[model samples]
Target: MFWALFLLPAWAVAGSACLRLCLAAVRAAATAPEAAGDDRALTLYEAAFLSGGPRRVADLTLVSMARQRRLLLAHTGWATVVDPRGRDEMERSVIGAIGPGGQSRIAPVRAAAAGTEAVRGLADRLVGAGLAVQDGAGSIAAGVRRVRLAALAVCALAALALALPVPSDLPDRLVALWFALPLALTLGSLLIARMEVHPYSRWASPAGQRLLTALTRRPGAPADDPAQLTAVALLGVHAVGEPDLRAAFAHRERYLEEPAAPGH
Candidate 1:
C-alpha cells in the first residue's frame, strides 16, 4: 500500500535509534569499571567533577568564591567580584569572566568558569585517575536523548498511520495495532535505558558514583571543610545549607534552558 512508503522510513529510523541506544547502555554497564576502595578517596574538586561534570566544577568554584567573600551572586542573576585577585587558576578564570569592571552576568561567569584551564585540568586528572569514564559523560547523556527522540518518532509514526487512509481490505483497527508494535519497542527501550542509567546518571562513572555514595555515608564528612561542602553543593544545591548559596546555585533550570554562551 502507498501508506507503507511513508511508514517505512519512520520505522527504520525509530528502530535504529532504539537498537543503538539499547546496545550502548548494555555495553556501558557491562564494561564499567568496578568501584575503587576507600583508600583512593576523591578530592573535593575531583568529587565535584565526577558527580556533575565541568559545570558542577564551575559551580563548586563559584560557591567557593562566594564563601570566601571574593564574589557575590545576586538573586537577579548578577555576579560581582568583591576581590579581584584570584588565589588559583579557577578563581582567576571566574574573575576574568566578570571582566575588568568587577561585574558581569552569572550565566557568562559560569560559561567562562567551565572553559578555564583549571576545569580542564580537573577533567584530565579525573580521566587519568580512571574515576571518570573515557568516553565522557556527554556521550552517555546523548544516548539517553537519542532514545527519547526515537520514542517521539515512534509516536509520530503512529499518528501518521492513523491519519492516512488504508485499503478497504485492511481493517483500521489492525493498522493501529500494527503501528503500536514499533511504538512499544521505542518506549520500552527508553524505559529500560532510564532504569539502567539512573544509578550513574549524573556526570560520575559507576566507580565514581560508588565512591561518592560511600563518602556521603560517613558522619560529618565534608561538613568541616569549605571545599568539601562546595563539592557536595555540586551534587545538588539543596545539599548546601546556606540559603543564599543554595539560591545562587539553584540556577540549574536556567542553565539547562538557555544555550551555552558564545565562545564557551
Candidate 2:
C-alpha cells in the first residue's frame, strides 16, 4: 500500500527511541549506586558537588568564606577578598580565580572557580565512589537528550510522510493519527524519565541522592551549623536565606562550570 511508505519511517522513529531507551536502562543499571553504608558523612565540598556539581561547590566555598568574614559578597554582584588567606584548597582556588586584583565580578569568579583543578579532583573522587554520573553520553542525562532527539526525529519523519504526494483514500484525521503513535512513544518515554529519574539524573547517583536526602532531612541538619556550608552546598545560594547572598551569586557566567556536557 502507498500508505506503507510513511509507516516505514514511523517505525524507524519508534525503533530508534526504543533502542536508545533500552541502552539507557542498561547503563543506568550498570551505574546504579549501592550505598556504601559506611555513614562516613560526606564533607561539605563533597555534598556540594553531588548536589549541583562544581558550581555549587564553588558557591559553598564562597558563602562559607563570606560568613567567616574572609570574603565580601555584595548584592551588586562583586566579590572582595577581606582576608587574603584561604582556609583550604577550595578557598584558595576561589581566591586565585578572583585574580591578582583580589576584586572581581561574582560571575567570572564563579565560572573560574568552578573549572579549577580542585573541582575536577572532587568530581573524580565522586565518580570513583559511584556518587556522580560520568560526564558524557553514557550518562542518564545524555540518554534523555538522545530520547528528546528521537522525538524530534519522529516529528520530522511525520512531516516528510505528510509532504509525500501519496494517493490514499484514508481520512485526513486518520492519516495524522497514524504518525502520532511513534511520536507519542518517544514523548511518553521522556515523561516517564522525568517522573522517575529527574533530579538524580542531573547530577547524583542513587546512593548519593539517598544520602543527601537523609542528611538534609535529619534533625540538626548538617546545615544547621552556624557556618551553613552544608545548606548552601545542597540547595545553592537560596539556602542562605539572604537576599544579598542570592543576588551575589545570581550573576553567574554560563561557562566551564560543567565542561563535558549535560550528563553531569
Candidate 3:
C-alpha cells in the first residue's frame, strides 16, 4: 500500500506536467465560439472593456453597483488573481476576478477611463497573452504524454520491489511509509490534471463585457473546431484584419459610440 509514497516527488513532477497537458488539451479542444464558458481571467478582460462608457448617470449607477459587489468580494479576498509576476502583469492586475467562485470584476483606471489609449493597449496585450497561454497549453499536453509513459516504467519497478521476498525482520512501519506516500501523492496529482476553464465562454455574458466577448469569440470555427485554430476577437468583432494591433487603439471608437445611458 505504501509503495507509491516513496515516489511522491516524481509523481508530483509528473502530475504537474500532466496538469499542464490537460489544460492545453482543453484549450486546443474548445472551438465552439458561443459555447465558451466562464473563467476568472476572461471576466477581467470583460470588466475592463465595459468600464469605458458614455459616463451617463445610469452607467455610473451601474458602475456603482459593480463597485459595491467588488467591495463585498474584496472583504474575503478570495478572487483568482493570475501570476502577478507574469509578462502580462498589467492586464492581470488591472482586471481580476472577485466574489465567491470569482464571479465579479475589478477594473484598472486606465481601462475604465473614457477616450484613453490604455484601454486598447490593454486589450491587445490581453489577447496576445491569452494566445500564448493557449499555445503553452498545447506544448504541455505533449510533455504530459511522455511523462505518463515514463511514470509507468517507474511504477513497474516499484511494484517489483514491493513483490520481492524480504526478511521478516524488516520494520513493517518503514515499509508501509516508503511506498504508501508516493502512491497517494501520485493519485492526488492525477486528480489535479483535469481542471477545465472554458476561455471562449467569456462572450456568454453581456453586462459590460466587451473584453470578454472579444477575447473568447472564435467566429470562424469549422465543423468540430478543425485545424486547432486560434484567434482573438474582442468586442463583437474579430481582430483578424486589425493590422499589427493598431486596432487596439481604435477601441475608443466604440467607447465614443456608447448610448447616453447604461443598458440603453
Q: TM-score for each prediction?
A: 0.77, 0.78, 0.27
Write candidate 2's Cα lDDT for 1-264 as tens digits: 566676777778677766766676565556543534335578888888878889888888899888888999886677889898987789999999998887877788888999999899998887777677667356667677877887787777767766788777786567778778877887888888788776535567666677787878777746434675677888888888778788777666533352232220
Residues 1-264 of candidate 3 have per-residue lDDT tens digits of 344443454556656655565555565444333333334333333333333221211122222222333322122211223322212333332333221232322222223432234434544444343422222224333544544654564566456555766553446556545555545544544445434332223212221133345444635542422322123222222323334222322332334332333220
Cα RMSD, model 3:
17.6
In model 3, the Cα lDDT at residue 100 comes to 28
Candidate 3, position 53, lDDT = 21
lDDT of 1 by residue, 1-264 (tens): 555665686678778887666655664555435433335766677777777777776777777788788888765466788999998887898898889978766776887888888888877766655566555534465566776787687668767766866663567677667667777877787677667776644456566677777777756656436455743544645576678776665653475333333221
Best-performing candidate as measured by lDDT: 2
After superposition, the stretches of candidate 3 with alpha carbons farther than 4 Å from their true spots are 1-129, 134-138, 166-177, 197-264
Query: Which model, 1 or 2, shows the larger lDDT?
Result: 2
